[model samples]
Target: MARIPTAELSRYLFAGQIGHRGCLRASRIRIAPTSSSLQTRQFASHVESQAPTATTVPPTPLRKQLKEQAKALKASGQKKKKKVDNQTVPGWELTVGIEIHAQLNTARKLFSPAANSFNDDPNSHVALFDVAMPGSQPVFQPETLIPAVRAALALNCEIQRVSRFDRKHYFHWDQPSGYQITQYYEPFAKDGKLELLARDGIAAEDGESITVGIKQVQMEQDTAKTTAQPGEVQWLDFNRVGVPLIEIITLPEIHHPATAAAFVRKVQVMLNAVDACVSGMEAGGLRADVNVSVRRTDDKCGTLGTRTEIKNLSSFKAVEDAIIAERDRQIAVLESGGVVEGETRGWAIGSTETRRLRGKEGEVDYRYMPDPDLGPVVIDLPLVQYLASSSGLAPDAETDQLIEDYGLTAKDAISLMALDDGARVQYFYNVLDALEQKLGSASVDTIAVDRGLSTLAANWCLHELGKLTELSNNLGMTHKGECKVPSADLAALLYHLHRKEITAKVAKELLWAIFRGEISQGGVTEAIEANDLWFHELSEKEYSDLADQVVEGEDKVLGEFLRFAEGKGKAYPQGKLMFLVGKVMRAGPEQRMDPASVERVVRARIDEVYIPGLKSKE
Candidate 1:
């Protein structure tokens, strides 16, 4: 050959190494001379020799070889085995753990007396210690410890009598101090557990509960918020610089995305119950950092693959979707013959995939050292004992109480608690109490079940009143946590509706009238009678006459009745009979008759008239 092109020579060398193992085996490859130069010829001769064959075939190109290898590998065993439990992809098992940073709701910062508040003017709440002034000293506040202990107790954590803070060293624009003050060596609380109930819709298995392990709950100081602008200008908000936080680290026990989301929700409910921290995530009160990883079915149970941390998930939905998207991403990486590096990642708003933020930092990288300024935190024994016994009831306990006391189903109890921080649940009890007092009964079971009041009250409070925006605002804690409709007033409406004195249609309209000042306290009965909203008692003769008028006016409905009476009925014709019943109710003023009574009367009239007409024709 006169001259060989560089591209073609490289292609031959690449394709010559392709082997049955689906990879390039460079040691077994042998090259042939493409140029007559002595240097090239000598190099070619030094390569391993191939045995002679009767017939030779041309080598396949590298691109085609790679595609064939990938396809063959996938078809052979890449997807042959499936995971037994909690499989997001067919052959892969996903693992997830979360780090929740919740800002404590306190009047002052953790170490300093600076006011702990948000959305105020920037720099207004900062103390000299918060800004890391040279001579400023840190003073530990006893008030901050109250909420932290309460939060730990709510999570069923074992509180450490002696815990100390350490300095986590890192250089960032937001941290005015050279280091971050946190608890790394010895945290405040450890070995906590949270149970995800099946009825809450986040259980890993259907109709079963999952218990997630909490590794530690450490107290830390939050860093200042940093906003980066164009041209390298950095803006810092120091309002959040020294806000108190509890870093709740969970063990790698969660597997499914829904379970992770549910776990966070349960934490929020717990914190709220104890008045520990600000539970809302949108206001930067709570944030989640999720660590996600994946492995194949053959791997050992404890042998977890490389994991990536997705940071600053602001909402429960974001926490759920981010884990799902990140887990799928890792599986795809391993399937393509690539290794997933440990890294920190960020999920941009509205984006499904996570982007790399930085390499994962280790403890050595953080250079953790005990803070010289702060001493070991001491907990009072009496206070701890008091909290253990008197901590606010969690949502689970409340759910159980609601079920046993009110005879409400688990679903109904959960729905009531979901409404605005359990305020609706409080209102629900108020209505029941008011009804009990009015009916002169002390037994919840008797009051709720004997008169059908439990289901009736739940329907009005959650289904009807909960749906109206104006009513929800005005009636739901608008007056210092008091219902505007006055639980007693709504109870009166339920009382009348239960006794069949007014139809449900009248009850709803009268409820709105109450909200508009048209109905006042003790005026439910007066208003119903005055407006003719009450159902009037009618004799059998009057009902029959009314039904006859409705049946004669609707010719088409009468025809269907005739068909049914003549034994040519295709179906039960119940709907057609109900239509005529509706006509009879409309014939009365305000349609005050009960629907069941209307249907009964209409059925009798069709039997008396339509059936007789069919007999005459026969």
Candidate 2:
């Protein structure tokens, strides 16, 4: 809670009724109706009243004088503090828009023959044309357009039949040429929408929807990397200079920071679905610049305050924290009788506040002009429709279908979809299919194949076998073909676990044996027999006698139970009964007593033997 020093406040000078310090006049400062938390003070009015007359003289500069007055005015009124994590910022409205640069999934650069890989040796992948010599011209890569269409279709963007490229000029160490090539006037896609399926960690209730908007998805070239050490001079690596990127621009439809984070996650998931991009924000494959602006709670969009753009957020956590920080920061500035200015800012991953990268008077013109060399690219309709059809096999569509076809809960279906690689995801569904087929022939109730086996398959894949198996992605291998565990063995293992023929723990042991190739595929019965992993379930008559023996033999539990039945002691009798049942369970490891049955039989024996004996004695 450090106060802004009087001297430090001088840098916030802006135009209007306020023109630095000497320009303060008799104009009134009006803020909108305040919430109870901010307790908005009429500090500007107070300062106006305390202004010097025309005849009066002061030695200090106008900027310094205004800063001192502004500092003193903010301290006069105190307000109630609101929780940082609170859902609503009562007096203010937040608007956020994200711009993402997703690296395209291609072998070479967008306009050059350079290889597009992040891990290559510095400048090793750069072509001579990437350095942009005087006579060089740009050539378009046809293969890169496929993933771009996939992204646009997944986001529900309207595909523009013809889009042209423009030259964007900027002076930076990262740019090889004097300017970069991008889609400025005519982007290939526009007018897309994404309706979020969740709200604040909860599934969207029936008939509740929040849709963030996409303004455009433009293909552009990435810049180079500038490597700088603490004391050494900076060095530029042109390896990534002309790498292709799909820039997805969104309208300012986001209010909550969590909503913003979830939106980014959804985009990343979709990008992965099409193999469009690696989309690893941490590794710079995908990154975002977030624009945040605030207005009064009742204010209309036209009157919204100036925005601050936080640039190059590397991860989703960074995106969330940066938005929250900028939101509260703007509120504090406005509450302190200062105007929020539009500026470019940088946010490090773990930083508490954003740092000003550069100041902005308004928008900086990139001087965009159509590229003379490259032609206006026309998107083929059939190609786009094919991508849309191919995306049906993606996780989003597949997850919903799994829920409908198998009657699995939405949570279970999503868990199955979160399994990363395509092969692993396919393996899960295939095993579920195999188990359903096996159960349909062997069981009386065919419905168990759909409901019971689906749940069992998802559970074992996520919990028991999933935790033990390693995916190709985890090993940093890009190939997504085959996984370690065979689907047949997994199906058989879940079958035994579902039937209570083996404990879940025992099932895990058997799965690992098959994973190590110690047991062959479709060898669940052989593995159980060889390893004594088979478990037994007690019949009703046998469990009844066992429960009777447990009550008779455990005298300590009986004393505790009898006193509790008479209401003479303050202990729970069920705990003692469960403890006695656990002892019987340990004695017969071969027979894995269903815990629900043990508890039921134990309670019945207690009611029949202990309570009735007391009544007979009385």
Candidate 3:
């Protein structure tokens, strides 16, 4: 070891403190000065020193200050600008378009026979063609195309007679091939419209309907999925590669963020109804890319402003929120005299701002060319016609049919269709089917179907079973075969209630008991008998006697009723009258007593006894 000079050692220590990266600057470092140092305090300073004084103006009186503040507030109130609608920005127009990639529910991939799945072991479902192996040719499967056509029909799109595929040239780690196969130049379907009404769960603030135009729906192959940490080794799953995907493009007609969300929801319902897609968004079955632009709302605004793309919004809420955040960002930029640059942006989870991902890619950047391997997809007129008529009903049509045929209200019908992704609606129909089978006919003569059985089923399915699903951690009721109670049991319970064999209250009690496993027997009738829940009709005279006893015992309520009836009281004793009815029902066999009959008897007794007494007093 060598002894270093004092100044050289000091310099080395300083350099070590502020590393070569210059993370810490010398000016930021602080050092205490000693008497021997250049920056030192004066020696022998006195304990007491005279302080310099400055002149000050008098403070304003509190009252006068308050008066000035009040005047300022009044002036501000008078000059306050008009408030804009919160649903939309003032002096600016927002336009949005959505590009959704929905996976087709087919057994095989779009170009190979590998099973189309997402949950299988990584790379287990990949085919040789998926990996782009040497001499492996792409075999187009018709199974994938059928569902695409079905979805197009459900969305009211005109099927193209001849659609061709093109290769989108791009190099990525996940994409083994040098290009992606998509229907870029000629899509399969075009010019469709989706009607969104107030009852469709997505409506304007004024409850007006919006018709969103569909630009095109094209069939394409999905790229392989990649999952990795930042600056780490990437894990690639080729199972998603060559999977069937239908790219649904909408015209930039949407103006509101919430409306954009509603559009995605409506499309999900339609796809599910047609069995074209079964996996929900949580499972990566569908994803949306939002394109948004904001322009000044003035006469000078003729052309649209620059648009930016927000990619891979997985949830509906994310879609709406991302649009709002990006719209506001663009508006702020334009208001600040800054040009809105077109770029690809990404929304961080739980953030209210969009971050730039990259500059927007131009079509020329893709270098798209006609796919040399795959031929043109030609659709026959007969097949299209058959699918148009034979496919499952669209969500709107299904809702309408439910409202009409089953005599259900618009609210209840839409709710049934919306619950658990339409699984509860199927449960409702299953109950109806079970009831019809038990009653032996679908005619009005059947006691079950005659008395709005479908409406009854809908009510129970939503209120009762929906609550059960919520209490059970939402594990049941959304998916078929996961309901807390079987549909057959529900049908049986509804039968008893409708036939007057059991009261509604008893029906609810028995339903919970069944769900909680408190019932010893499996059948609803057996459980009702075991729980002593059967309904019994009371005669008119028996009801009158019970009411007379109740009225005689409730003298306080009787006096109140009399005073009110004779105009000597302030408010009517209607609630007290119902209280009396409750006492009468309790005085008798409450479970067996009909509440409506008891009420009628109680009201009659009150009128018969109190009204006459009041008349005599008058």
Candidate 4:
């Protein structure tokens, strides 16, 4: 909350920062549209992901030992959680501040005309300005500010009417400009806070709360990348130089690794929701650095513990793992009567422990000064509102409204917003709006939850469409532009589903078909007519015969029903009934068949055939 002068702030960033980029950025930023910000991974189905593929090295014995220790510490922390988290780890209290660097989603670099692309040939996208060539002067990229403002608003920060930029001097191969330009003093936004609605890696129980302080949101240029392999010369790639990055620095309010990791994931999600970044941490478009320190449980206001900064965690899991490992390591040092040293450490992807990168220095290490090359950034309230309105960002306070309106849980809305995939969220609501136009407002509400429309849409995007895109190796559902399925097509498909013109299966098939280009423009009707992928009503006689054929054909369900009829088997029947019902519908003559009709026929046939036959036998 306290503002340091430009010079002092510059010094502070340099002193506390890791070499090259103030910190080595993490591996990737994965953005998912879900209930909680980055609470769930849209990329991986689950929250836990293995380290990025690039850093999957074999762990040394020491690494294994450290990992085991981390597990032990984490388990102990879980056990100790009763009242205060400060006492959760037992014998030591761990506190953390997370720094997330989200690479802005843009076509051009922050201060260069070069294209900002992932997976292109290395250095091919680099401009002369990127490498800081003598004659190449840095230029402002207007595109960067939109996402930055969106992010600040999402974090509940006050936008500075005018923000200044300063340069922090540091030397590294990746930093071609010996002094890196940053907002060490005046950032675009400051003094904000966000509540991570998670406790222990899942949604906090209903009626629970946790808040992390937002120190500032600084719009800075990402440093160049360096590839170092032991025993070989290090490679410097300026391809990443001058890439626009937003640094979300949090207050040291997180007391546990799970909470810290959740907050980072939340930021990743929010960044995506605001259309600020693509949110793929594995791709290095986003990454996190965690600062960890341990203190005595009784030393509430005592001097802070010696902080060890972990640099470049590739994934959320890695962040948690590194925190746990470092937490235990620091606690052990103190328990053994040794002082915890302040240093910068790097997380080895395959290992359980952190490697000491360098001794942590003070701000004096990087002398801060105003950059003569770049002028101040003037951000007005209108600009902030325009960005927020254009991006369709939901207010951070509207979690409850989102849940009630969409029939989603608080976590679900938070996940959706956190990924900052506002477009997807808007598209989903537009589907609801389309349904409301037909089914009425109340009808739409019933459909979203009771009928599973909300879950269905999320699944179709997460699993089915995700699979299709992944197979094609596209960016998947995260990026609105790159996703193969048009929002209109998805909405139309859902509309057909709501009207009961198509079963869920039929709807999915239609979506895939359309996305695969098997069907061209137009809505559900056109898609259905084009591909013969509709579900229609079956005649009573035809449906009955189909149901009879399925029951007789599948002995498993037939036997189970007979056993169930005799009251020998318990009540829940898993497959036979639905399986028979599905078989009748799919094998029906009508391309567009009514599924409810199939269920009705299947039940009627069971009563006429199975019940009478069983009674006669008795």
Q: Which one is best on TM-score?
A: 3
Q: Please, what are the lDDT tens digits per residue for candidate 1 over residues 1-618? A: 245355544433322232333335333222321223332343334332432222334545434554676577676665422222333567777889999999997999998988887766544566767767658978888889889999999988999999999999996546657688999989989999998888776744524888889999999999877544333333355668889999999999887788888788778767877778764564468899999999997776769989999999987767877887798889889999999999999985444478999999999999999999999998878989998788867779888877876677878887777655446777787788877777778755567565357867887878888656542444545312246577788888888787888888888988888777788777888898888887675767788888876677576667777787667987768988877877777887545467777788788777777768756866
Report the lDDT of model 3 for residue 239: 71
**lDDT per prediction?**
0.75, 0.70, 0.76, 0.67
Q: Model 4 — which ten-residue stretch has the worst lDDT?
A: 30-39
The C-alpha stretches of model 3 lying farther than 4 A from their native spots are: 1-85, 171-174, 205-207, 225-236, 348-351, 439-452, 473-484, 500-522, 530-618
- TM-score on alpha carbons, each prediction: 0.71, 0.71, 0.73, 0.68
The C-alpha RMSD in Å for every predicted model, in order, reads 19.6, 16.8, 17.5, 11.4
lDDT per residue (tens digit) for residues 1-618 in model 4? 454355543322222112234346522221111223231122123312321234323434544555676687687664433322432466567789988888888888888878886665444566666655557788888878887888888888989987877888887656766777788888989999987654315223212668789999998888867654343334344567888888889888777777776777767666766667765575577889999998988886877798999988877777877888888888888888999889999986635568899999667887888777788888767777777678653445455566665566665565555432444455555556655655565665566664467665655544565556544645344444324566567767876776677777787677777777776665657757776666565667777777777677465566677787779987846466787777776676645467667777777777678767766766
In order of lDDT, best first, we have 3, 1, 2, 4
Best by lDDT: 3
Residue-level lDDT tens digits of model 2 in 1-618? 456453423211100122234445443221111112211122233323433333313344433554675565466563323223543478788889999889988888998877787775555565656766557889998888888899888888999999999989875546757688999789999999887775323122212557888999999999877654233334355668789999999999888777787778778767777778854564578899999999898676666679999998977777887888788889999999999888999986545578889875331467778899999999889988888887767556776776776666776666555444334455666676567676765542354345666666767666665566343124121334234566767877887777888887787777767666788767788879887877777888888877766566566567776777789988677677779778667655434677767788777777777667755766
Q: What tens-digit string does per-residue lDDT give for candidate 3 at 278-320?
A: 5656557999999999898893848888999999998776787
Displacement of the residue 398 alpha carbon in candidate 3, Å = 2.6
Candidate 3: residue 415 Cα off by (Å): 2.5
Q: Of the candidates numbered 2 and 3, which has the greater lDDT value?
A: 3
